[model samples]
Target: MHPETHLALHHTRATDLRAEAAAHRLAAQARRPYAIRTRLGWTLVEVGLRLASPRPAFAH
Candidate 1:
């Protein structure tokens, strides 16, 4: 009886783990990174800022 109960608990836990993993996979696919798009805008802004800012000290 105790062994059967333990197996039942283990089965429930495995199902819970599978559900959690499925949820994570769904979330990952639904909200993916737009690296090229994001990076393009950011890189342009950064370049503009650097061009507009003063240069650091340097010896001749």
Candidate 2:
């Protein structure tokens, strides 16, 4: 009912949300290398396919 109480509640909730976000960010950071590797692997596979495929010959 009091303004101070409402402010405190908001502050506490904000702190909790920030902490939760930090935890998620850390987890994502930990897995970042794996994500990058997966992307790179897919890119390499795509490049390989492109290289292996026959190209259209240009007529003069």
Q: Using lDDT, give the best candidate's number.
A: 2
Q: Write the per-residue lDDT of candidate 2 for residues 1-60, one digit (tens) a residue.
A: 899999999999999999999999999999888988999999999999999999999999
Model 2 accuracy (lDDT, Cα): 0.97
Error of 2 at 55 (Å): 1.3
Q: Estimate each model's TM-score.
A: 0.57, 0.76
Candidate 2 error regions (>4 Å)? none
Clashing pairs for predicted structure model 1, backbone only: none
Assess each prediction's global lDDT (C-alpha) against the native: 0.92, 0.97
Misplaced by over 4 Å in model 1 are: 33-37, 56-60
Question: In candidate 2, where is summed lDDT lowest over 10 consecutive residues?
Answer: 28-37
